[model samples]
Target: TQLLEQSPQFLSIQEGENLTVYCNSSSVFSSLQWYRQEPGEGPVLLVTVVTGGEVKKLKRLTFQFGDARKDSSLHITAAQPGDTGLYLCAGPTNTGNQFYFGTGTSLTVIP
Candidate 1:
Protein backbone atom coordinates (compact mmCIF):
# COMPACT_ATOMS: atom_id res chain seq x y z
CA THR A 1 0.00 0.00 0.00
CA GLN A 2 1.15 3.52 -0.74
CA LEU A 3 1.81 5.71 2.26
CA LEU A 4 3.44 9.02 3.04
CA GLU A 5 5.71 9.34 6.03
CA GLN A 6 7.14 12.44 7.65
CA SER A 7 10.03 12.88 10.00
CA PRO A 8 10.42 14.95 13.18
CA GLN A 9 6.84 14.71 14.35
CA PHE A 10 7.36 17.78 16.52
CA LEU A 11 9.67 20.74 16.32
CA SER A 12 10.22 23.80 18.51
CA ILE A 13 12.56 26.63 17.73
CA GLN A 14 13.23 30.33 18.13
CA GLU A 15 11.41 32.90 16.07
CA GLY A 16 14.21 33.39 13.59
CA GLU A 17 15.28 29.82 13.22
CA ASN A 18 15.00 27.91 9.97
CA LEU A 19 13.87 24.36 9.45
CA THR A 20 13.24 21.74 6.81
CA VAL A 21 10.55 19.10 6.70
CA TYR A 22 10.71 15.84 4.81
CA CYS A 23 8.10 13.69 3.13
CA ASN A 24 8.95 10.24 1.91
CA SER A 25 7.20 7.26 0.38
CA SER A 26 8.04 4.00 -1.28
CA SER A 27 5.39 4.26 -4.00
CA VAL A 28 5.21 6.66 -6.88
CA PHE A 29 2.40 9.17 -7.10
CA SER A 30 0.72 11.03 -9.91
CA SER A 31 0.72 14.26 -7.93
CA LEU A 32 1.83 15.41 -4.53
CA GLN A 33 0.12 18.16 -2.58
CA TRP A 34 1.50 20.20 0.32
CA TYR A 35 -0.69 21.91 2.88
CA ARG A 36 -0.31 24.05 5.98
CA GLN A 37 -3.13 23.87 8.48
CA GLU A 38 -4.09 25.58 11.67
CA PRO A 39 -5.97 24.12 14.55
CA GLY A 40 -9.74 23.67 13.96
CA GLU A 41 -9.47 24.60 10.30
CA GLY A 42 -8.87 22.58 7.18
CA PRO A 43 -5.48 22.46 5.59
CA VAL A 44 -4.75 25.14 3.03
CA LEU A 45 -2.89 24.25 -0.15
CA LEU A 46 0.66 25.51 -0.11
CA VAL A 47 2.23 24.11 -3.27
CA THR A 48 1.69 21.19 -5.59
CA VAL A 49 4.62 19.86 -7.60
CA VAL A 50 3.55 17.08 -9.93
CA THR A 51 6.49 16.72 -12.26
CA GLY A 52 9.62 15.10 -11.05
CA GLY A 53 12.56 17.46 -10.43
CA GLU A 54 10.16 20.38 -10.11
CA VAL A 55 10.81 23.07 -7.55
CA LYS A 56 8.49 25.81 -6.39
CA LYS A 57 8.96 28.57 -3.86
CA LEU A 58 6.55 30.85 -2.05
CA LYS A 59 7.91 33.82 -0.20
CA ARG A 60 10.01 32.30 2.55
CA LEU A 61 9.23 28.69 1.80
CA THR A 62 10.72 26.36 -0.78
CA PHE A 63 9.38 23.04 -2.00
CA GLN A 64 11.14 20.39 -4.05
CA PHE A 65 9.95 17.21 -5.70
CA GLY A 66 12.12 14.15 -5.96
CA ASP A 67 13.21 12.98 -9.38
CA ALA A 68 11.38 9.69 -8.82
CA ARG A 69 8.18 11.35 -7.56
CA LYS A 70 8.42 9.29 -4.39
CA ASP A 71 9.71 11.99 -2.07
CA SER A 72 9.52 15.71 -1.36
CA SER A 73 10.98 18.35 0.90
CA LEU A 74 9.90 21.69 2.35
CA HIS A 75 12.30 24.31 3.64
CA ILE A 76 11.34 27.40 5.51
CA THR A 77 13.59 30.38 5.96
CA ALA A 78 13.44 32.92 8.79
CA ALA A 79 10.70 31.18 10.69
CA GLN A 80 8.24 33.26 12.66
CA PRO A 81 5.55 32.64 15.20
CA GLY A 82 2.92 33.18 12.56
CA ASP A 83 4.45 30.36 10.58
CA THR A 84 3.61 27.79 13.20
CA GLY A 85 1.18 25.21 11.96
CA LEU A 86 0.80 21.60 10.97
CA TYR A 87 2.50 20.75 7.72
CA LEU A 88 1.16 17.87 5.69
CA CYS A 89 2.10 16.18 2.45
CA ALA A 90 -0.40 14.23 0.43
CA GLY A 91 0.11 11.99 -2.56
CA PRO A 92 -2.71 11.27 -4.93
CA THR A 93 -2.84 8.06 -6.87
CA ASN A 94 -4.21 7.28 -10.31
CA THR A 95 -7.76 6.97 -9.03
CA GLY A 96 -7.54 10.49 -7.61
CA ASN A 97 -10.36 9.73 -5.23
CA GLN A 98 -8.11 9.33 -2.23
CA PHE A 99 -4.90 10.76 -0.88
CA TYR A 100 -2.21 9.46 1.45
CA PHE A 101 -1.31 12.11 4.02
CA GLY A 102 1.96 12.16 5.82
CA THR A 103 2.15 11.59 9.55
CA GLY A 104 2.06 15.38 10.00
CA THR A 105 4.70 17.83 11.29
CA SER A 106 3.90 20.16 14.16
CA LEU A 107 6.11 23.20 14.35
CA THR A 108 6.25 25.74 17.13
CA VAL A 109 8.17 28.95 16.75
CA ILE A 110 8.68 30.73 20.03
CA PRO A 111 8.95 34.43 20.19
Candidate 2:
Protein backbone atom coordinates (compact mmCIF):
# COMPACT_ATOMS: atom_id res chain seq x y z
CA THR A 1 0.00 0.00 0.00
CA GLN A 2 1.21 3.49 -0.78
CA LEU A 3 1.27 5.91 2.09
CA LEU A 4 1.20 9.69 1.79
CA GLU A 5 2.39 12.09 4.45
CA GLN A 6 2.05 15.86 4.92
CA SER A 7 4.31 18.18 6.81
CA PRO A 8 3.59 20.82 9.44
CA GLN A 9 0.14 19.35 10.03
CA PHE A 10 -1.20 22.77 10.98
CA LEU A 11 -0.64 26.40 10.15
CA SER A 12 -2.05 29.75 11.23
CA ILE A 13 -1.33 33.02 9.54
CA GLN A 14 -2.65 36.51 9.17
CA GLU A 15 -4.46 37.73 6.13
CA GLY A 16 -2.31 38.75 3.13
CA GLU A 17 0.37 36.31 4.24
CA ASN A 18 1.73 33.45 2.19
CA LEU A 19 2.22 29.77 3.00
CA THR A 20 3.29 26.55 1.45
CA VAL A 21 2.18 23.03 2.33
CA TYR A 22 3.95 19.86 1.28
CA CYS A 23 2.91 16.29 0.61
CA ASN A 24 5.44 13.48 0.30
CA SER A 25 5.66 9.74 -0.21
CA SER A 26 8.24 7.15 -1.07
CA SER A 27 5.89 5.55 -3.56
CA VAL A 28 5.56 7.07 -7.00
CA PHE A 29 2.11 7.97 -8.24
CA SER A 30 0.46 8.39 -11.58
CA SER A 31 -1.14 11.65 -10.58
CA LEU A 32 -1.34 14.06 -7.67
CA GLN A 33 -4.16 16.33 -6.59
CA TRP A 34 -4.86 19.09 -4.08
CA TYR A 35 -8.06 19.93 -2.24
CA ARG A 36 -9.43 22.44 0.21
CA GLN A 37 -12.40 22.01 2.55
CA GLU A 38 -14.36 24.05 5.01
CA PRO A 39 -16.18 22.91 8.12
CA GLY A 40 -19.37 20.94 7.60
CA GLU A 41 -18.55 20.67 3.91
CA GLY A 42 -16.94 18.20 1.57
CA PRO A 43 -13.45 18.73 0.20
CA VAL A 44 -13.22 20.73 -3.01
CA LEU A 45 -10.75 19.77 -5.69
CA LEU A 46 -8.33 22.58 -6.42
CA VAL A 47 -6.01 21.18 -9.04
CA THR A 48 -4.53 17.96 -10.37
CA VAL A 49 -1.01 17.43 -11.66
CA VAL A 50 -0.52 14.43 -13.86
CA THR A 51 3.01 14.94 -15.16
CA GLY A 52 6.26 15.29 -13.33
CA GLY A 53 7.29 18.91 -12.88
CA GLU A 54 3.81 20.00 -13.79
CA VAL A 55 2.51 23.20 -12.27
CA LYS A 56 -1.03 24.52 -12.09
CA LYS A 57 -2.20 27.82 -10.78
CA LEU A 58 -5.64 28.78 -9.56
CA LYS A 59 -5.71 32.49 -8.90
CA ARG A 60 -3.27 33.02 -6.03
CA LEU A 61 -2.79 29.31 -5.36
CA THR A 62 -0.12 27.27 -7.09
CA PHE A 63 0.27 23.48 -7.22
CA GLN A 64 3.35 21.54 -8.24
CA PHE A 65 4.30 17.94 -8.79
CA GLY A 66 7.79 16.66 -8.07
CA ASP A 67 9.85 15.29 -10.90
CA ALA A 68 9.70 11.84 -9.40
CA ARG A 69 5.96 12.01 -8.82
CA LYS A 70 6.56 11.11 -5.16
CA ASP A 71 5.86 14.55 -3.79
CA SER A 72 3.80 17.68 -4.29
CA SER A 73 3.40 21.17 -2.93
CA LEU A 74 0.75 23.85 -2.68
CA HIS A 75 1.56 27.53 -2.31
CA ILE A 76 -0.90 30.22 -1.44
CA THR A 77 -0.18 33.88 -1.92
CA ALA A 78 -1.85 36.81 -0.24
CA ALA A 79 -3.97 34.51 1.82
CA GLN A 80 -7.38 35.66 2.93
CA PRO A 81 -9.58 34.68 5.87
CA GLY A 82 -11.70 32.78 3.40
CA ASP A 83 -8.64 30.63 2.73
CA THR A 84 -8.94 29.11 6.18
CA GLY A 85 -9.65 25.45 5.62
CA LEU A 86 -8.28 21.94 5.55
CA TYR A 87 -5.85 21.28 2.70
CA LEU A 88 -5.23 17.77 1.47
CA CYS A 89 -3.14 15.98 -1.13
CA ALA A 90 -4.08 12.65 -2.62
CA GLY A 91 -3.16 10.21 -5.34
CA PRO A 92 -3.85 6.73 -6.49
CA THR A 93 -2.02 4.00 -4.61
CA ASN A 94 -0.10 1.17 -6.18
CA THR A 95 -3.35 -0.71 -6.35
CA GLY A 96 -4.55 1.89 -8.85
CA ASN A 97 -8.09 1.44 -7.59
CA GLN A 98 -7.47 2.87 -4.14
CA PHE A 99 -6.25 6.36 -3.27
CA TYR A 100 -4.02 7.55 -0.44
CA PHE A 101 -4.44 10.93 1.21
CA GLY A 102 -1.92 12.79 3.26
CA THR A 103 -2.51 13.55 6.90
CA GLY A 104 -3.69 17.03 5.84
CA THR A 105 -2.79 20.62 6.69
CA SER A 106 -5.22 22.75 8.61
CA LEU A 107 -4.71 26.41 7.79
CA THR A 108 -6.30 29.24 9.69
CA VAL A 109 -6.02 32.59 8.03
CA ILE A 110 -6.87 35.25 10.54
CA PRO A 111 -8.47 38.43 9.37
> For each candidate, how many residue pairs have backbone atoms clashing (under 3 Å)?
0, 0
Model 2 bad stretches (over 4 Å): none
Q: What is the TM-score of each candidate against the true structure?
A: 0.95, 0.94
Model 1, stretches more than 4 Å misplaced?
A: none
Residue 42 accuracy (lDDT) in model 1: 99
Q: Rate the local accuracy (lDDT) of all candidates.
A: 0.92, 0.92
CA RMSD of all predictions: 1.3, 1.5
Tens-digit lDDT track of model 2 for 1-111: 428899779999999999999999998999998989899999999989999999999999999999999999999999999999999999986677987888999999999
Clashing pairs in 2: none
lDDT tens digits, residues 1-111, model 1?
Answer: 438999779999999889999999999987799999999999999999989989999999999999999999999999999999999999986899988899989999999
| Model 1 TM-score relative to the real fold | 0.95
TM-score of candidate 2 on Cα atoms, chains taken together: 0.94
Which window of ten consecutive residues has the lowest lDDT sum in model 1?
A: 1-10
